[model samples]
Target: MTEKTYPKVGGRSAKITLVLLVIVYIFNFVDRQILSVLAEDIKADLN
Candidate 1:
């Protein structure tokens, strides 16, 4: 006898997930860029 799995998880299409991930990534990149731009000034003052 073979066992069968029941009850599927709520599914989202791959495309939608990819789109959301990309948007979040872009926001993260923008934040990182701003920090990167200011990094030198902060470092110079810390030491």
Candidate 2:
């Protein structure tokens, strides 16, 4: 029988990438929330 090799996981780069992605997602979520809250004001200002 031959031995099978598997790909490595849980590296430093992977951790950093995950953290950055989470930060970006958090910011995007907050931005949408703020926009929604100000939607009426924005519409009035644009007119």
Candidate 3:
């Protein structure tokens, strides 16, 4: 029987991708928080 091996996830490109994803996730979280905090004011101003 033959075994199949997969590539490891410890390369430079992998590291860069992980960092970028984390940064994007953090930015999205902060943006949502800010929007939630301002939702009432935005609605009031629009109305």
- Residues 12-45, candidate 2, lDDT per residue (tens digit)? 9999999999999999999999999999999999
Task: Judging by TM-score, tell me the better candidate of 2 and 3.
Answer: 2
Selected candidate, larger lDDT, 2 vs 3: 2
Model 1: lDDT to the true structure: 0.91
Candidate 1 per-residue lDDT, tens place, 1-47, comes to 99999987546786788889999999999999999999999899999
The model with the greater lDDT, 1 or 3, is: 3
Candidate number with greatest lDDT: 2
- Whichever of 1 and 3 has more TM-score, that candidate is 3
Best by TM-score: 2
- What TM-score does candidate 1 get on C-alpha atoms? 0.51
lDDT, residue 41, candidate 3: 100
- Where model 3 places Cα greater than 4 Å from the true spot, the runs are 1-8
The lowest-lDDT stretch of 10 consecutive residues in candidate 1 is 7-16
Clashing pairs in 2: none
Residue range 1-47, candidate 3, lDDT tens digits? 89999988589998999999999999999999999999999999999
